[model samples]
Target: MNNLLDSFSNFSYRNKNFIFLSFLILPLLWLGIVYLGSLLIFLGHSFFHLDGFTGQIVYEFSFKTLIELFSSPANIDILIRTVALAACVTIGSAIIGFPIAYYMAKFTSPKVKIFLFIAIMLPLWSSYLVRVYSWKLILAKEGIINWFFEKLNLEWLLDTILSTPVIGGPSLSISYIGMFLVFTYIWLPFMILPIQASLERVPNSLINASHDLGANKRQTFYKIILPLALPGIIAGSIFTFSLTLGDYIIPYIIGTSKFFIGQAVYTHQGTAGNIPLAAAFSLVPIVVMVVYIYIAKRMGAFNAL
Candidate 1:
């Protein structure tokens, strides 16, 4: 048995076609088990109808749940809001992360890199729930920001935040600011690493050459570095945007009860006991992610990098 196994291992490695085939097929195996299987299971669940009276799903073929999901005005609103939130978070992460990644790649000393990297990564090692819950504490009345403002005599900022009327009333508690901050904080490192990698790979000689040609800082950034880093920027944005879209915990912990699509799905599956609708609702994030990835592909983001 040992001789046979050793012979096959040698034969497999020696055969280039077999090796290439294995490379191609391994990913399919992964896709088969993960994505395709999950999607089929979801589609199967979509056929199952829920009993409103008993709050259990019945294994019956129906489109009623799907229709109801689409027809509802609240569902539409939630979907739109979730997309808008994701867009804002993506843009915010890009803007903030670019500077940090650029500074780290271009200027930060090697001696300090280890310490700064640890500091940057410390938040990720901590409990996600603990961090998110802290946001609630900070955003709630008598929170740190409010306390700081009060101490600094910046009453106007507080008044502005607390006064902005939304669906019902004051916006501070359910304000979009809290949601954006948490999203940006959680995903900033993802954005930074990619951009930093791209920026570090950028030849210093090119920047010097541009400078020699009398290009200013902003001119060089836009003309040379920005174009190269665009791929990483888009890549980071995709991850941040997609993750924020499906985020159930962060908004639930930090923001108000106003429905996000993720919350809607959570309610349907867990609380409302509408498995089919939840399954249908689950498609929202998947489709949006696919669309964003497609757009990235069209931009030739991979090849350009």
Candidate 2:
């Protein structure tokens, strides 16, 4: 037994690749068999058809579900709405997070940086549902926001926002604007962390060199900082965009009757028992992320990570 153990240790020491593969084999199997296997099975359901009369799923493969997914006006609307919201959330996160990230990276001392990092990450330590529901209350018609507006005589401004077409509803909590706000808030940390990381990697010497060469602050930023940070921004966008695309809970709890892709999937699978339709809805975001990642890759976004 002792000889066998010695021989095994010697073999492991000699073939580091074997040690690496031994450690990796279980995780790779888990990923391949459990994760990818389940995903393939779920996606395969999209090819099958559901019977309307008997409420049974036909095991045979067909394009009927895919056709229905694209052809239906309502489904198309949901898809469009989801895509638009994701885009809006991504843009909003970028806009709001960049300044904070820039300040954290370039201006703050180590102690202040730690404080800011904690502030950014503190919300994530709470339950996701709790955070979302808290937003629901904060944005409600009779919430503190409304009271504050009334106190300041700015109720008209709030009313005007709530009265706007398409994006507006009877209350802020039930409006697209509110949903957008929540999405942006939830994903802002993701955006900030990446941009901050990228910006930290920017050499101070480069900035000094640019100044020495007679480049102004604006010129230096536009030419050097922004270009280098583009990858981080894109990486962050991937998180914010993909997350908004698939989030059902926020839309369901906070927004109007309009369906996003996630809500549609939940309804089709859970309530309606139309598994194929749900699977098809699931594929939309996957396809969208594939395209998005492809574009991000083309722009060298992975370099920042």
| Top-scoring candidate (lDDT) | 2
Taken over the whole model, the C-alpha lDDT of each candidate is 0.81, 0.93
Cα deviation at 1, candidate 2, in Å, is 3.7
In model 1, which regions exceed 4 Å deviation? 1-39, 47-63, 166-171, 303-305
Per-residue CA lDDT of model 1 for 1-305, tens digit only, reads: 99999999999989989978878898998899999998789767876778878877888888877777778998888889899989888898899989888888888899777666777678867877888877778777778887898899997877876566652225445777778788888877777777777788789999999999999999999999999898888878778888888888887876777888788889988877787988888887888889889999787555434
Q: Clashes per prediction?
A: 0, 0
Task: Write down the TM-score for model 1.
Answer: 0.83
Q: Which ten residues in a row are the worst by lDDT in model 1?
A: 164-173
Model 1, residue 148: C-alpha shift (Å): 1.0
Error of 2 at 204 (Å): 1.6
**Model 2 lDDT tens row, 156-242:** 999998899998899998899999999998888999989999999999999899999999999999999999899999999999999
